[model samples]
Target chain A: MSNQSLVDAEWALSHLDDAKVVFIEVDEDTEAYAGNHIKNAIALNWKTDLQDPIRRDFVNKEQFEALLSAKGVSNDDTVVLYGGNNNWFAAYAFWYFKLYGHSDVRLLDGGRKKWELDGRELVSDVPSRAATKYVAKDQDLSIRSFREDVLKAIGTQNLVDVRSPDEYAGRLLAPAHLPQEAARIGGHIPTAANIPWSKAANEDGSFKSIDELKALYEGAGVDLNKDTIAYCRIGERSAHSWFVLHELLGVKNVSNYDGSWTEYGSLVGVPVAVGDEPGTA
Target chain B: MSGCGAVVGGVSLDNVDITNQAVIQGVISSGNAPASVGYARLLDRNDEFVAEVPISKQGEFRFFTVAGDWTIVALIPGANSRTPVQATIGKILDVDIAVIK
Candidate 1:
């Protein structure tokens, strides 16, 4: 069950020309793939292609179907996703694929970072596949959570704020590079554990060993047995954590709060806890 | 909704005016060549990760942060290095990191 959702560079390299497999790159720097990418890989902009144009939510089922169809991704193809920033956006897309009930989807371990670091060949040639009549299922809501679920889980479930410590402590509203006006207030949900998503990744951008991952969360006071919800300012980073907890560790009940702090912190009358401590109820 | 993080990979700030911003910017290189494929990470005083961005094709990276002591770590193929700098408001600090393979 553990290695079922991940593939290494070697496996991916050997299958570069496999007709039954598709490689998709979803990068944080949206432009990364354009510079160079794995042979025959297609690019999916996490913002434009995946998200709904007017709504704050993801694309509807029909839209997803059209997207994959245009990308020539068949329902039976094995989709392997990779990206920059330790596969942050890639994992987010992986969650989206799972939400739409796509089977046989997996992540490229370490993603673009590892691919480049290993001195692997990345070609600028883009390949085109004939469009397929893609079909998508209703969103699997079990893996996704809304602000209400977050509020309800407060002090009851294992709520994990997978942002930088500064963000969790209210020292900064958002990451240092981005604008600081994402939320009306700054701080994390009460009784939430602050475990930055970067902890699950190595300096080289690959995920740590399974034993290391288990110890990292358990050492951070995240009860593995409890139903857990992971959140970041937006959802991508938390999706990485959700992948770790749910897919990698085989946790029975884990969800990613896509609305995250922007929705939760902006909600009026809801309690917000500042400082380094995970405040009590 | 607005995007959450900056667009990375071969980004150029040549036209960006950082006149009044506290910025930590640099070019990453190994030996005599630019380390074009990699990521640059900004770490706080406590050595905790703050943010990361993919380096430009020209091996450039930048971070707009509060004026303070910070460390910049470059993760590239066959090489990695960290450099410390003290940033000040209204001024740009350039710290070029040379990774040894």
Candidate 2:
């Protein structure tokens, strides 16, 4: 289903007339991104620029649009999003753009690690200057998942978790960078599936092809045709799943949970599924 | 919500989530030579501890969820783990630390 699943580092290097998109590495420290990055990739502070605690959600529409314009993202630019792991933040950026009406976007299959590991070049501290107008078409809820849908889909649809074993088990915890309780009250979704995001990539950080990817999903006992919903910490990692299912597997009925665990795990009341150390139901 | 420990790379995590987990990955370099390494967790941002982790055979170090947003300063101890060697911290944000050797 991929027009081209693996967008090589060289493509990114050679295709750019000017570094238009910014690579936002989300963490507590800026030193690393400051040291070296994807040339024009700006270090986006997720907390400061991405989310606003006061609103308890992604920034408001005007603010969000302004933020995009401030970042120099325009309506027609084809953006490439990526980050450290599954390019989670990059996926978030992708989701943000799509949510606000932009669609010409894609994620760097392996992200910074893959790029760096492959001996691709790196850029440090120099600010990239390329400005364009990013416009919003509509908040396509179709591309995103909501708690209500997740709650309704609990038994009806399948929830595919791209996190690790610890996360699936109540014993392991995901880091919630919010002002609320960050731990899960229960374990995974009822009778849900677990397929760590890293599995999509090989040891070297390149994505597997349609055959290899299909083999991976089938090996996990996951049925792509069923009603499926993907979720991760804040929906960042899951967006990768959305891309994989839709773009790779051609799986329809796929949605990504926007609130993800941050809201679900912190809720004072919800239908939670706990585990007995994660092995039993 | 996320249940993964911490992403060793990327920024702006000044607090820990009580309900979820995340992952953090990075390399500890010596001068210009990147090496696998580990350090003690400073639960409190201001305190230091005597904990050392042998870098994985792959030359990487990680922390499960001692606390989010807790700064990872080079802890070479007598060698200055906070030494300033010009290594990228991760993707979160950027900083330059000059550890006193």
Best model per lDDT: 1
> So what's the TM-score on candidate 1?
0.94
Model 1 residue pairs with clashes? B10-B56, B10-B57
Computed on C-alpha atoms, the DockQ of candidate 1 is 0.52
The C-alpha stretches of model 2 lying farther than 4 A from their native spots are A1-6, A18-29, A128-132, A175-186, A276-281, B1-60, B65-101
lDDT (Cα, tens digit) per residue for candidate 2, span A1-281: 24443355666676544544444454323444666777666666555676775765777677777777777777666676656544556666666666777656766776765665555777765665455454566577787778888778776667887755445555445432222243346367666677766567654345778798888788977777777888866676687777777667777678888677666777666666666322322
Docking class of 2: incorrect
lDDT of 1 at A245: 91
Kindly report which residue stretches of model 1 are placed more than 4 angstroms away from their true locations once superposed.
A179-183, B9-21
lDDT (0-100) at residue B7 of candidate 1?
A: 56
> Distance (Å) between predicted and true CA of A247, model 1?
0.7
Interface RMSD of 1: 2.8
> Relative to the true structure, how large is the alpha-carbon lDDT of every model?
0.86, 0.56
Lowest summed lDDT across 10 adjacent residues in model 2 chain A is found at A175-184
